[model samples]
Target: MHSHPRLPPTALEDCYSDLRTDSPLDDNSMSRLGSEMRHGVTSVSNKPKSADAFFDAWIAHVNETAVYGKESIDPTRSTSYRFIWRSWCKYLASSQEGPNAPYTMANPLLAVPVDVSRFLASGMKGSKPGRAISDVTRRRYYSVLQRIYAFCASQAWMECSPLDTLAQQDIPMAEKHTGSILTPQQWDACTRRYGNPAGNTFEIRDHAILMLLFKLGLRPEEIRALRVQDFQIGIADMPTLRILPRSGPAQERTLPLDDQSAEAIQNWKRVRKDLAVVINTNKALQADFNDDRLRAASDTLFVTRSSMELAKVPLLNLVKAHIERSCSEAGLEMPVRMGPQIVRNTRLIIWLHSGLEVDAVAVMAGLKNRKGFLHLLDYCSESVKQKIQPYRRRDDDPVSVTNMLKE
Candidate 1:
């Protein structure tokens, strides 16, 4: 729960310099650099003329110094932290005695655990009334505040982190739901509806993506990060997928592709190449599209119909949309949530039930160890249990006892 000390400005300068020297800053880094610049100017405005300006400046300072400088934090994580902090600021501004009040603006950091707890329990602005935030969200809220207060304490801005008293026990998490994994029947029904690669460009892309998730056990982000070069189809052995390291401690792993998955990818690749040529030929369309991202056209496998690299939100939307359609077509109710994860869980469960060794399954699933696969045990059916029974120790197995009395 304790926050690490902030790196000195000089240290940050050196870090940024090293990053720049290693490779050109990607869009993510450039965005962070812009925020850092804003923070540098606003950090000096400690005594801004108005309460509104003071709060803005304080928030900016927190983002620049505490959030952005942490090289270990990914861009997605950093964005989430900033968003949670901003929500807190918005809640305070709406309060009568909050920091936005003319008298209290100067002492904006004067928050206690009680205030934080209330904020966590309160309904979010756009959410339904009486629908308090979930415990998981509450825990995240506590973490953001804890980190912010720890940073404040490190700066001597506050005496201590009020969240120090808060424990994991304070927030009651929901029990893990085993039903999140799709039943075999449901999986078959859904796949039968949309797994065909003979459809149009969008259909071909969705089919390929779903195959990667359901057949290859790939996470959504992994699918998004995949480049054309990552596919090793020409190998005489077997087609393989090289998953590059991105958001986790796990090292990059290469997984052999199943026949169906390889074929689905090949079908999509043919269409993707044709689409890219068309998009690149239209100068006006190409210019308009390329203006969005800093990088030139990438070799990423999944992309928009216009051939730009696929973004996170749209990729998720594609998964959800296809799943919903498939569920409707199959005359079955869609799972409460349908995403790439359901496909991944289903695939992993199938692998386990198919009698694949746990270590081998873990490697194919891009996990570091067998321990990470333990949670998926819930998805194992009686049939799967029967399959794995031979691997389990028997209760009546003879116990090995070493004799101490040697001749």
Candidate 2:
């Protein structure tokens, strides 16, 4: 006698089935059965949920649903979320569950409070290396775990989320690892003044990449993700490099390129064009290029030479080679492990010491706030600060300020 509406395509089959399952017995029949089975009619306790199982589901949901067709959180964030999920899952797996042989292949979902606590404690211990997992990473994991619990609770799988009660205990805050910002003298001695080893195309490109990183303060991932189209030479007739980060819901930023950076970029672009022409001489080059993009997700502005032929580890290997060769040949201090972030930190330090307005620096560095820059500011040397004081204020000399004060 009763009727129901059709389910939407997005509705789950289980939800639809639950809606459609008809009552098998009338009230009187159910009452008779209940009377017969009264002694055995106890309620079933909620089942335990494993962090591993929950994390697997969470990542799948994030990839498939959270970022599906959404431009707000770009590919970089999506990848970061994936990494965060994977790391947490590994931690949960390594940890011991509530007194039951650590849930190895046996009812991981039955994991309770102890497993969660152990994982958090272990993660905070910095047992692995290079400073314990950051507070930001821990917070992100906590949020993900909370979402997992919420999902399980919605499905009637958990009595309550472990995270709900764990809030009372304090997770130790990580000592902010201040990144060292190279002073102008340090930067010059290391980079510009050091001079390239014979100015090959490779060296030119590497220098350009270094300039972009240190001058603009771009994230490694952001730099890696940058495409050739992202570089514009003549925007507003001023030589510029526009770094469009694929991480937020914002427009692209145009950086006013210095003469050195502009020249470096031009040199690299010419080399890249020549490289492309050589590669494309082969009839199958287009197909190879597509395959390269698919494999690496690196339609990158800066790419390794013979990048099409590289295996999975080429980028890091290329970086190592560059650092070793450049430092050895130039007689400069071997850079403290060359990576994209180091250059970015270098630029932030340069701007802060030069007395660039914090907000303006943030905008140029393409940061959402001053917080990240403030962290980088911590590494500046007092000596560098003293040297940079004269460059900080553009509009007034020391004498002018003194005369104005006298009036």
* lDDT scores of the candidates, listed in order: 0.58, 0.51
**Which regions of candidate 1 are displaced past 4 Å?**
1-134, 137-179, 193-195, 234-237, 249-251, 276-296, 374-377, 381-407
RMSD of 1: 18.3
Task: Supply the global lDDT for candidate 2.
Answer: 0.51
Alpha-carbon deviation at 382 in model 1, angstroms = 9.2
Candidate 2, residue 285: lDDT? 45
Q: What is candidate 2's lDDT per residue for 326-407, written digit by digit as tens?
A: 5666576776656555656876777766867766776877776454444454465675434333332111112111221132
TM-score of 1: 0.50
RMSD in Å for all candidates: 18.3, 17.7
Error of 2 at 395 (Å): 40
